[model samples]
Target: MSLRGRVLGITLLLLVAALLSSNGLVIGQLRHDLVGQVDERIRGLATVAARLPSLPEVAVEDVPQVRATVEQQLIRDVHLAYLGPDGGVDRVVRAAAGRPPELPRLDAAAVAGRGGRPFRVPATGGGDGWRVVAVPRAGGDGSLVVAGSLGVVNRTVRQLTGRVLLIDSAVLALLGIAGWFAVRGGLRPLRRIEATAAAIAAGELSSRVPELAAPRTELGRLSAALNGMLDRIEAGDAARAASEERMRRFIADASHELRTPLFGIKGFTELYRMGGMPERADVDASMSRIEREAARLVELVEELLLLARLDEEGTAVPLHLTPMDLRTLAADALHDLRALDPQRPVTLTGPGGGPPGGAPVLGDEARLRQVTSNLVGNTVAHTPPGTRVRIGVGTEDGVAVLEVHDEGPGMT
Candidate 1:
C-alpha cells in the first residue's frame, strides 16, 4: 500500500480492535441485563401465583384469568400446577399447550424454603435457548409450581448483537477513509520537497518549493534549510567559475611575459659568447638590456611572493589593534609623494572622530603599510605628472572606513 493507505490501515485496525473489545463488553453486559430482567419478572409473577391461597382443587374458571395475565405479560408457554404432599401434580392450569419442553433442573431442593426457583432450559422454536423460573404455590395439603419461558429476551439479545456488529463495521470503514486523507494532508510538504530536490538534481537550479503554504513543522524547517543550502551552493559555484577563468587568463599572461624576457636574454647571451667584447658601446648596451630584464623578473617574483603571503597569512597575522592616527599616516605618505613628484600633491580629509572603536580588527601594521604603499606607487606610476590625489578616513556605527580617492582612472 501507499503511505497514506498504510497509515490509515494501521490506525483503522487499532481503532476497530478497540471498538470490538468495547462492544463485546457492552453487548455481554447488555445480554446479561436483558436476561436478568426477563428472569426477574418471571420469578415475580411466579411468586404472586404461589402466594394465592390454594384450595383442595384449583377451579378451571380461575385458570383462564391467570392464563390471560401471563399472556399479557408476554411470558411464553406458562404453566401452573399444584403438587400434592407427595410431589405429584394434583391439578394443572395450562392454556393452549401440548406439553412444554422439560425445564432445566430447578434445584428446588436448595430454595424450597425461599418459595422460588430459576434455571435455563432448551427452548423449542428458538435459536440457542431460554430462561425459566419456577415458584412454589402453597396448598391445603402441599405446594404448587409455576413455570414460564424466556425466549423473547434471548431473541432480543441476538438482534442487538447483530446491530452492534453492523455499527462497528460501519464506523471502522468511515474512520479508515478519514485517516487516509489525514495522512495524505500531513505528508504533502514532504512530497513537495522531494519533487523540488529531484528537479534540482536534474540540473534545474531554480527549482524551489513555494514556502507560503508549507506546513509549520519539522519538514517545513528542513525545506527552508535546503533552500538556503542551495543558495550557498549556487553562489560558491559561480565564484569558482569566475576564479577559474581569472586564473586561466593570469597563467597565459604570466607565461607570455616570462617567455619574452627569457628569449631576449638567450639571444643576447649567445651574441656575447660568440663575439668577444668587440666594442664598448655594444657590450654596454647588451648588458643594460639584460639588467633591465633581470629587474623585471625580480619584480614579478616579488609580486608573486606577496600574493602567496597574503593568501597564507590573510587573517592570521599577529598584530596589536589600537587606535591609530590615520591623518598622520596620510600626511607622511603625501609628503613622500611630493618629494618624489615635486608637483603632484596628496591630501587627507574625513570627519574628525579619531576613528570609531570597532571590534578590534587584527593585522600586521607593516603589511598594511605595504598595501598602502603599493596603492600609492601604482597611482604615481600611471597618473599624469600633476594629478592630485586624496585619502580619507572616518568611523561610522563602530566600523572604521577608509578611502583612497585619486584623480586618475580607477581600473581598466
Candidate 2:
C-alpha cells in the first residue's frame, strides 16, 4: 500500500478500537440503569399493594381500586396475589383457568407477620417471563403481593442495544474516510520526492526537488538534502566536460605544431641517406635544415611541459609576484617578437594611465614573460607577412591589463 493509505488505515483501526470500547461501557451502564429503574418501580408498587386489606376478607368492590392504582402508577396486568399459609397464591387476583405450573409461588411464612414483607417470584398466570413481589398488610396478618411480566422491558433493552451498535458502526465508517484524506494530505511531500528520485534515476541530471524555505518536517529536510546532492552532481559533471574539452584541444594543437617539424626532419634525413649529400654544400644545407627541425621539436616539447605544469599546479604556485614596470615588460616582449620575425611590423605602446612612468602590477615575472612569449609566437606562426601586431599595457580599474592586438585575421 502507499504510505498514505497505510497511515490512514492504521489511524482508523485505532479509532475503531476506541469507539468500540467506549460504546461497550455505555451499553453496560445503560442496561444497568434501565434494570435498576425497573427493579425500583417494582419494589415501590409491591409496598403500596401490601398496605391494602387482606384479600377475600376485603370487599370485592374495593379490589378494583387497588387494580386501578397499580395500573396507573406502575405497569399494566401486574399479578396481585394473596398467599395462604401453604405458600402458594391462596387467592390470586384472576385465578385464571390455565396458569403455568412452573410460575413462582410466594412464601406464606415470609409475608404473614404484622409488618409487610416483599418477595420476588416467577410469573403466575403468565403469557411471558415474569418477576413478582409480595408484601404483608400494614395492620393485619394476611398480605398483598404484586407481580410483573418482563416482556416489554426486555424488548426495549434489545432495541436500545441495536441502536447503539448501529451508531458506533456509522461513526467508525466516517472516521475511516476522514483518516484517509488526512493521511493523503500529510504525505503529499513524500510523493513528490519519490517522483523526483525516479526522474533522476532516468538520467535527468538537472531534475531536483523544489526548494523549501526553512522547512520544518522530516520530508522537507529530505528534499533539501537530495537537492544539495543533485547540485554537487551537476557541478561535477560540468567540470568533467570542461576537463575533457581542454584535453582534446591540447592533443589537437600538439599534433598540428609537431607536424611541420617532423616532415622537415624526415626529408633531410632521407636526402642525407640517399647520397645526395655527397657534396659539402648540399650536406651542410641538409644538416642545417635537420638541426632547425630538431630545435622546433624541442621547443614544442618545452611548451607542452609548461602547459602541463600550469594544469597541475594552477596559478596559485609560490612564485615571485612583485610589482613590475609595464612599459619595460611590453618593450622587452616586443623586442623578442621582432627578433623572431623581424620582417613583421610590431610596435609597443607606452603605459596609457598610471601613477608615475607606468602601471606596476603584481604578478609572477617568469610566468608573465611566458604568457607574452606564447602570444607573440602564436601571432608569428599564424599571421600573414607584414601584419601589424601591437602590444600595450594599461591600468583598468585597479588591475593592470595587457593587450596584444594584431591586424592579421584576429583569432578564429
Candidate 3:
C-alpha cells in the first residue's frame, strides 16, 4: 500500500478500536449501576412484603388488603406473587404500572426459604426480563416473590450507546481527515527527492533535491544527505568529461604529429620509385632526409608516451627547451615540401634581408620542427601543384620567427 493509505488506515483502525472498547466499558458500567439500584429497591420492597402479615393492621389470609399494603410500599414495576409448597405460582398480585415476568421453576433451596438474593427471569410477550427475590411468608405454607422489570434500565443503556456511538463516529471521521492532510504534508519532501532521483537517472546529473526547513527533522536531514550525494555525483561526472576531452585532444595531436613523419618517408620513397632522383647525391640526400624523419617519428612517439605517463600521475608535461635554430627547421621543411610535391615552387629566406640566415632560440627542436612541418604540410595539401611558397626564417628582437606563405585560397 501507499504510505498515505497505510498511515491513515492504521490510525483509523486504532482509533475505532479504542472508541468501541470505551463504549463497551461505559455502557456496561452504567447498566451495572442502574441494575444495582433496582436490586436495592426490590430487596427493600420484598422485606416489606414479608413483614406485612406480622403487623397488626394486616392479615396474611386477607389477600386483597395485604396486596394493597404491599402495593403501597412498592417501587416502580415491582410486583408480588405467592408460591405453594409445590413451588408453583399459586397466586400473583399484579401492580398497576407493570405485570409479573415469567418466573422459572423454583430451585429446592428457594422453596425452602433459602433464596434471599435477587435472581433473574426471562422476558415474556416481548417484554424486557425481570429481577426477582423469594422469601417464606410468616404463618403461611407458601413463599412470597417480588419482581421488578428491567425495561427502563435496558432503554437507558440503549440510549447511552447510541449517543456514544454517534460521538465516536464523528471523532473518528475528523481524525481521519486531519491525519490524511498531516501525512500528505509530511511526505512532500520525499516526493521531491523521488523526482530528483528520476531526473538524475534521465542523465541530469546536476539535478538535486531542494533544501528543507532544517537538518533537525528527519526529512530535512534526508534531503541534505541526498543533495550532498548528488553534488559528489555531479563532480565525478564533470571529472570524467574533462578526462575524456584531454584524451581526445591528446589523440588528435598524436595523429597529426605521426602523420608528418609518415608523409615525408612516403614522399621520398615514392620519388625514388619514379626514378626522379637521377643523381647519386640526390638519392643520398633523399635517403638521409627519410632517415632523419624516421628518427623524429621515434622521438615523437617517446614524447607522447612520456606525456601519457605524466598525465596518469596528474603532472604536467614539460617542454624540452634547448638552443635551436629556426632556419635549420625551416630548411628541413623546404626539402620535405619540395620532395612531396616537386611541381610546387618552394623558397627559403631571411626576414631582414633576402638570403636564408640562422634564427637561433631556446626551444624544443622536435616540437618546433613538428609545428613548422604542420604549417608546410597544410600549405602543400591545399595549394595546387606549382603554387609558390615561402619559408621565412630569422630572429627579430631576440624572438625566433618562422613563417610559411602559400599562394592559394585562404581559409574562410
Best by TM-score: 3
Candidate 1 matches the true fold with a TM-score of 0.58
| Candidate 1 all-Cα RMSD | 12.2
Per-residue lDDT tens digits of candidate 3, residues 202-226?
Answer: 9998787888668898877888888
**Could you give the candidate ranking by TM-score, starting with the highest?**
3, 1, 2
Model 1, 273-313: lDDT tens digits are 87845998978877886786566566555655555455445
Report the number of backbone clashes for model 1. 1
- Best candidate, lDDT: 3
Better of 1 and 3 by lDDT: 3
- Give me the overall lDDT of model 1: 0.62
- Model 2 TM: 0.57
Off by over 4 Å in 2: 51-53, 56-69, 77-149, 164-188, 198-204, 211-214, 253-268, 275-412
Best-first order by lDDT: 3, 2, 1
Which lDDT tens digits does candidate 2 get at residues 1-412? 8677777778878877887788778777876665565566656777766665554644333577665665665565455666655566566653322343244444556554423333334444545555555566566555566555566666777787789788878887887778777777777777777898899899898999975445777766877889999999999998899788778877876775665456556656665676757899977866775675577578677776666567645553346788886666676556545545556787666344232235688787755755665666677678898898878786667667676778887766
TM, every model? 0.58, 0.57, 0.80
For candidate 3, the per-residue lDDT at 68 reads 62
Considering summed lDDT, which 10 consecutive residues are worst modelled in model 1? Answer: 351-360
Where does model 1 exceed 4 Å of error?
Answer: 54-62, 77-108, 112-127, 134-136, 139-150, 164-186, 212-216, 235-246, 249-253, 270-299, 308-412
How many steric overlaps does candidate 2 have?
Answer: 0
Comparison by TM-score, 1 against 2, better one: 1
Model 3: which residue pairs collide?
none
